[model samples]
Target: MSVATLHYIHDPLCGWCYAAQPLVSAMQAQLGDRLALRLHGGGLFGEPRRVDAALAQHIVHSDERIAQLSGQPFGEAYKQGLLADEGTVLYSLPPIAAVLAAESLDAAKAYPMLAAIQNAHYQRGLRVVEPQVLTELAEEIGLDGTHFAQALARADGHTLFEHVQASRRLLDEAGGHGFPTLLLEVDGRRTLLPHHHYYGRPDAFVQMLAGQLPAVH
Candidate 1:
């Protein structure tokens, strides 16, 4: 019996990463027990170095393109509510920290919480920068709110910083193009999978892996 590892490199605040969620979910379902699906946080955004009309316009345009390609929903609330609201820059540290905090408590909750956070931001236009909002989300997902809050309180500490660094290292090792990168590894050797497999037909993703690796029986 052979086992393959699929590493999904993503960031919670990445629009493209959110767009790839369905594809990743399908991959998880189709692969079943044939492979290990590992989630890695790729650092994509930072404190608002420069966010203005040009950046906002580019974001909307890119989001539209992603929607067209992936058939993923980018709600009007996200556009009109979050994007229209000013004083909100492209900050990612808090969301990533929340993911790390969840992972610390329960590894299984991390990726699911990532999906929930993405939905909360992309659909509901809820604030991801606020610890309070993230805590509420944690509670909604059955995570211990007090524990999540304590971990988030230590967001600026070494633990979260180490998670960020580890993600960056994995991303670089995979030679990822951007967020939502996928890599396959078997017997200690790694191979980068094309992003197109995740676009609209995730079934094709399953077929592609089946052709290259052991089939899930």
Candidate 2:
């Protein structure tokens, strides 16, 4: 089978990344074995910050805009439950670390684990920055909890720093500004797929990206 790789460079905490989730899923399903997708985490909040009253409000506003534009879900739990809190600082490392861990242990689990993080954060009103929370989420998705816990705990500074560096390298190499960037790679060549259409019509988006895939005999 002829196959190509799709490089997804994104921050797990990014609103736009969450918005693009469904589209990416649809693309993978349509492409089947014709596509190989890799997930990369960009450290958007390398230096974490507490979601203060003002910042929380701003996050809600920005996420709302993303939801409207992309037709993605921004539940009341996220807007009212999570964002209403002032004590929680938003950090990107824990979730990124968890994703990398999943990728290492079982590559197939990586994207599912990421979707779990986004769902936990936006739909379930869960604070995903805590290692324990990530462990529980991974376990809930049928991943080995012990392995996940170890991975979560052992994600030392260097490990996380390397991931952040790698994320930045992919972004710079792709000439992308930031998160939720998708690149289609075939035979060592790369092309950036315009992510706008993926937000609305994923089937059409996949068709545009894959370009008239062969029919089943």
Candidate 3:
């Protein structure tokens, strides 16, 4: 059987990526070990930036649309707390590095780490850019404290920069249009899947992927 790889291009800070979590989970359950799920952090907020009142309001409006379409919850902590906090810095690399750190220690935990980071950000209004926060999230996801600390320390530096660069290159090669781009690769050919069509309908998403899997002979 030919290997089928699904490349997910996303950023932790992206509300849409969080909205796509259900679809990702459905794909995981449907494909199991039959397919490989690869996550790429495209670094939407690669630089350290602050969200002003106006920008925060804009984000809230966008988030409401996402919640309406995808059925993903946006906690009050996020809408009222994090967004309202003027001094809070937004950067994607730190959380992306946390994911890389988890992946380095255990591949299975990578997605879980990403999920946890999203939860902490959207649900709990935590400052994910802080190393301490990232470490706590890692431990919460069952990763060993000592090893994860070392891995995160290493990843927070040049490793994360290199990974983001490579991820962006992949996006450019795929002709992707921003975060949450899903590319299905069967054999050596890659086809970009129209994932937005099934935002809240994960079953439909899995069925579509199932129809394509037979070609991987």
Candidate 4:
């Protein structure tokens, strides 16, 4: 039997994407060798701009809603510490490009590195815009901090742009109109898993995938 591929289309800096991380991780753990996971960068912000006050409140409220609905933890620090810092730029491209750089260095480390960045930004309230924070994360995950930094500094601008473009194309093709979408391929066919809203229990999502998949070696 051919190995199944699960493509996770998401933006690294998206709050809802952060909420979905635990479930994705759980799915990955369960599938293991039976599946291959791929990350597609969904650029939520193509252009940099200051987050408006209303927009910030909306984001925080959405996070709260997800936590309440899915039972995911959304601590006060996530909003107060991370989003409250005015100096921190809310650019999604840098971190997305950074993950691509990490993937180029080591594919296995890409997802974990991305998850770490999200945890730092959303959970731990670390400033992702700061080079020092990213560097520290790179080192923590046993990646070459210098190379990671260099790659991020000189990331293929056009390539990253193209990646976002491609992801948008794929999203359109899949009829997906949201962030944190999951596209699964099995037996040469693609299916978009329905995730109407955020989910709190990662295990439930994992079980959903396991149930959908045929029992085969």
Candidate 5:
């Protein structure tokens, strides 16, 4: 049997990534240890940037479309609070570092940490760029807050920068043009899988990948 790895290229603040959370969950449940699921943060907002009115409008419009197509909820708090706030920042590095920190402590906690961060931004209207917020999210997912914070601190400087760069390289190598790209690697060869059609339908996503997966025995 050949080794299989699924690379998920995404950004913490990307609305489509939030929408694809369910598909990720389905993949985990169905594939289990037979396939290695790796997350790559694409650093959509590598530099710290505040959300301007125009950007907020664009994000709201894009989020609405994502919710409509993927059936993911954009909470009232997000819509009425975050988007409406003029002082909101859209930095991705802090949240990405938080995910990396969780992965360092426990590989299984990585995805859950990402999910929690996404929920913090898209559902709870929390400031994911804040260190306290990221730490709190980690604790919510069962990680010891102090350890998580320390791990986050360790990943803060050069480590997080390197990870983001690596993820971007993977995106380029995989021929992915945007966030939420799924690249499946069997043995050594790689193929980019379709993600749009599978939105709001994780069962279909699993079924499609089922064919590409090699027999276990």
Candidate 6:
């Protein structure tokens, strides 16, 4: 019998991805070895885009909306401390590269590392651009900080570009052009997983997955 795989493609800086984390975790726990999970880094920001006044306000409002809908916490500090700094650049490649590096070392650690980066950004208001911050997150996820840092530094230029290219290819192939999209592949067939509306219960997501993919064993 062939095993089924779940490919969760998302961007690290995406709010909806943050909201879906718990639901993915629940599905993984229930599905166990019947499911093989893979993380694809969907690059949300390709270049260093300046956060203009309008964009900043939009981000602040989007963060609030995500918090309200997903029950994910967003503190005033995240808005005031991080977003208030006008020069804050939004380039997610570095952090996304860090996740890919961690996955190379140990696949199971990807989600935890992703969560650590998110918490550092949205919860603690830390700038994820700094290498020190990424290294600290690596340590927190049981990865060799030095190795992870070296991998990130080496891959900072070309490897990340390649990963983003792969992500783009996947997105194009799947005909998906949205953040927080979930694609599950079973028996060589790929299908989109249904997502609950922005603020719906995570359990609703679990039920949807359960109905779509039953246990193989």
Considering every candidate listed, which one attains the maximal TM-score?
5
Model 1 regions more than 4 Å off? 49-51, 215-217
- Candidate 1 structure quality by residue, lDDT tens digits, 1-217: 3398888888888888877888777877777467777877766785643446777788889889888988888878889878876666666778888887787788777877888889998888888878899999989989999999997787656766787788789888878887878888877888998966568777887877767776456
> lDDT by residue for model 5 over 91-140, one digit each (tens)?
99999999999999999999999999999899999999999999999999
- For each candidate, the alpha-carbon lDDT, in order, equals 0.80, 0.84, 0.90, 0.78, 0.90, 0.78
Worst 10 residues of 4 by lDDT: 195-204
Q: What ranking of all candidate models by TM-score puts the best one first?
A: 5, 3, 2, 6, 4, 1
TM-score of each: 0.90, 0.93, 0.96, 0.91, 0.97, 0.91
Better of 2 and 4 by TM-score: 2
For model 4, the superposed segments whose C-alpha errors exceed 4 Å read none
Q: Which residues of candidate 6, in runs, are more than 4 Å off?
A: 198-200
Candidate 4 positional error at 186, Å: 0.8
Q: Model 5 segments beyond 4 Å from truth? A: none
Ten-residue stretch with the least lDDT total in model 1: 42-51
Model 3, span 1-217: residue lDDT tens: 3268889999999999998999888988778577788999989997998999888988989899999999998888887899999988999999999999999999989988999999899989999999889999999999988889899989877788888999999999999888899999887889999999999999999989888885544
Better of 1 and 5 by lDDT: 5
Tens-place lDDT per residue, model 4, 61-170, is 88887777666665567688656755556777877887887887888888988998887887777766566787788888889899988877765588888988888888
Off by over 4 Å in 2: 212-217
Residue pairs in steric clash, candidate 4? 70-200
